[model samples]
Target: MTKQPSSLTSIASIVASMTAVAIGNGMMLAYVPFALTRSDAPDWVPGAAVTMIAFGGLVGCVIAGPMIRRVGHARAFSCSMALVILSALAIALGMHPLVWVLARGLYGASGNTNFIIAQSWLNHASANHWRGKAMALFYMAYVIGLGTGAWLFGQIPADGNLPPLVTIFFTALALLPIGLTRLPTPPAPAKVSIDIPMVWRNSPVAFIGVLAAGGLSMVVQGFTPIYAAANNVSQGDVANLMFVMQFGLIAIQYPMGTLSDRIDRRLVLIGTCLLILVAGFLALSATFSNLILLMLVFALFAGAVETVYSIANAHANDRTDPADFVPLASTMLVAWSAAATVVPLMVTVLMPVFGPRTFIYAAMAVAALYALFVLARLRKRDEVPAAERESFELKSAQMPNAGALVEAEARAE
Candidate 1:
């Protein structure tokens, strides 16, 4: 038997750390909305809070590359975890609405930074042959952590300081594995110029897929809890729903990635968009009283929408040169973040006119637009030959480290 690479060993440690922090982040994402609604805060407040987090994510993604170069991955990750702890403490102390918004934004930035560090580190460390499989494993671990967090939050009280304190405990625990791991620092990334126009010109389908996915994801993951609460679903059920949705997300990553590897990724992307449209409409029309059926619908919805980032990313890479991977990925991340930041606010506005179901309509609309774009692209360009295509790798907008890994693999090849 051959000995495994030391970089692979280090990646395992980083995965553990990432999973821990993701659990806390996932719990907070659902808990905040549920808690605020319980407090009789206005309908728009929850969606606004979610938007703040996405805005902070944009900031984090912008600075993360430079920060990682300066501090090294382990130290940068630790600093982000520490910031998360501080943000949780702020919420625990019962700050005012404005303060809570600021704290949530801080949480988003720190959490995004941590994700970037872990992803970049893993990609930097893993051998080229193992990159796709390694990233799939990382994505699976992340989804599991998120699902576990949602389920755990359901078991605890959302009122008072308990929720934030739990978040702090988990976040603090995430730091332990990082401190213990003795890993080599990755080489600093070369600075790349982001050209959004070039990226779109290269693959309009991919650009729109990511943008639509971002908008749909914020509604599904960020606003769904509030929607459930508004519809008279019990807090326990809301948590369970979130866990089910995350479970769908976790269950689909490897299968979708494997399928994309075997076929034209455009076909897979179009299928996913159709799935989102159907699921969104069904979810909107279904009576909330049928808990089991609703859970199933949401599971399908999450599974499909969550796979968009990976599929779209794979499609984009298929169309571009290997040298362009880093810049292309960076541009897409920014675009996705911008869409996520704005979509929730739109939800806030539409909720008054469309009620709690506005997010569903929003999901349907985006899915339709994305499907149209994918069809148009098919007519305009021939598919990339499978022999020339890169292996499909799973990715999440929350984890923007794949770009660095793509550049590393390109250099190796």
Candidate 2:
């Protein structure tokens, strides 16, 4: 029998995982955009430049598990952190737009690999009893990190070299815990052939959820700061708004995750969609600088669900065999990548017409339709018997073989 991971490992991993994600968020919000804005590039140049890096990140997510398996998590994560530090130093010096974009993309991959590897570790480490709660905790750290990053942007000078060097220093510091930990190695995952049709068949909604979550969330993340500034919303208020929103995500993730674990996953999914819709409407009305109302809307919008990334992972986990977790997660991440690529371009187009707040409005409008579609699916499937529904156990006896991962290994061979 495989020895189950201790809670100590779980806790320590969570912290280390949290550090990776936090610093990753920090780097993205802090370094990349700063470099882009500070570059001698034209207005449109920064967008493409930022996308260049983010697109690579999406690629990293797709290949994360196999990379981890081949290189091992610690090594992969360490390398990523080191790259992030280097990227930070580069951003502090303020490179050319294309160079900044390339560096950001390279830096972005570090976070992607770190997250995927950490998640693979978490999936293997979890006992069935605490799986949902544990996943919730994993998500909570990410939530905190995202909110903290936005707030830190306000605290740190966006165009200055100091924030990059300083944030990089802190990110480098995050490597210590993982290095010091004496965690045992995870079991080798099973090697299965890839079936694109099979993954789509198993988790279509989850796949779409990946789109809604990634597209909407990216629209929010990449543009919200710019949006707030464009609007009359003060910088302090914007930071506070994000802070409250993250805190709301923190408040809700565990309960919502556990709630999903209990009920039919569809209902849980619908609930998530509804939350986004409400958030959308609230944000749409948030054109006013009414501080209370803005924060309230942000809080509502942020709370009730945070499934953007985590839910798809959970849903994929739910529908998949335990052995398929890593591979399936990789498949779901592609959905994130596809959405990330498209949404920014879409929102950027909207900016000239609706101003910067257009991203949030666009997010809400998209989510409303998505929620409706999901609701339709739920209603159509309502007659299906619960027992007939396949519920997944997140853990598998062995891991699924990701095709891309195998190809990479074959190339290495």
Candidate 3:
């Protein structure tokens, strides 16, 4: 019998696909609002448009598992990229606000499908000991792509269709590596129940952590600029704030993952949530004055909030049988998508009533609730011993494939 090559051999192509998706996402995040602002749309239009993307993501999460099973990862990813390209063209064509909302939603859904495919493939390919480091590299690539996309946004003129066109070009470029590479496809996942009650029973901290982190992440990415602007921060500075936040998110992944591997992951999760809560309150109270301090706070908030997702995922893995990873991960991704979809709309209502700082308040509330839940869970259940626990791997709800990879790995063992 011939020996097959390890999945790790395809790492380069996986990372490339991840990077492309991230860049496209980052570009859209910056471009959509800017384009809408120029269109003389009402204030709610931009936020609603961004929220539509999350809503699409929720829809994508529901379909991606089945889609990947039917078509294989490469083709599924290709389809996602095609959707992104078409959506970008639709936006560039100066569609009506309502049409743009639908287009953006398509972009969100397709982008999420790409994420699931890449992450699943990576998880399936990675050796056990190398999983954490592999995830770190994946995260680094994702963050760098986002930062680069934001930089591209600055270079492109917002006045014309150029931004979306450039986004389309990048989305197309992302397809190249996938099309050219001969990557192995994972088999169809086994049928397993994804009961929310079972997930919480297994790991409440992880369950709540995912929900809170989703809310925190969406608020920061979708509304931070608006929050800054309302506080009289300059537009350029708002861009800088997001850049610093992304840098913080990139910088923290490996260190946090390594730390979680060594100790109680719940402790790491709790500490990070506290930090995010503190940063959120500080940002709210100070009104984002003192540019340097504001950037630092934003960075801390972004880094901590983003890290929670991975920690929660790792924590959930600690509690579940290896075979259950796929269903558990899918459920968590759905939880994240639901939170991301609803939180912004909730904030939109709150902002008018509570003032522009409402986003910060929303973040703080999430952080506080998560922290409290973690503490309570600690009291109710003993920690998984470090010796017995799986090594912490930095994952995002963005990549739904990790679960499938974990299931495959379990079967191999």
Query: All models: lDDT?
Result: 0.78, 0.58, 0.75
Better of 2 and 3 by TM-score: 3
Location of the lowest summed lDDT over 10 successive residues in candidate 1: 401-410
Model 2 per-residue lDDT tens digits across residues 1-413: 35656564455754664555574464456345434444455555555544555576676755565666677767877777787777767666765666666776776576566665665556566665665556556655666666676577566655556667766767866788777766655544334344556667767667777667666656655665455544545545566666666666545555666666667666676776677777777777766547777766666555543554454556655565655544565565666666766877777666667765677777777677777776776754432244543333222100111122322221121
Q: What is the lDDT, from 0 to 100, of the residue 7 in candidate 3? A: 45
Candidate 1 structure quality by residue, lDDT tens digits, 195-255: 7898888898888888887788877888888888777788789888988888776567568
Off by over 4 Å in 1: 1-7, 397-413
Give candidates' CA RMSD values in order. Answer: 2.6, 5.5, 2.6
**What's model 1's lDDT at 398?**
54
How well does each candidate superpose onto the true structure, as a TM-score?
0.94, 0.80, 0.91
Q: What's the candidate order when arranged by decreasing TM-score?
A: 1, 3, 2
**lDDT ranking from best candidate downward:** 1, 3, 2
Q: Tell me the deviation in Å of residue 290 in model 3.
A: 4.2
TM-score (C-alpha, index-matched) for candidate 2: 0.80
Error of 3 at 289 (Å): 6.2
lDDT of 3 by residue, 125-144 (tens): 66665665776788778887
Instruction: Tell me the lDDT of model 1 at 141.
Output: 89
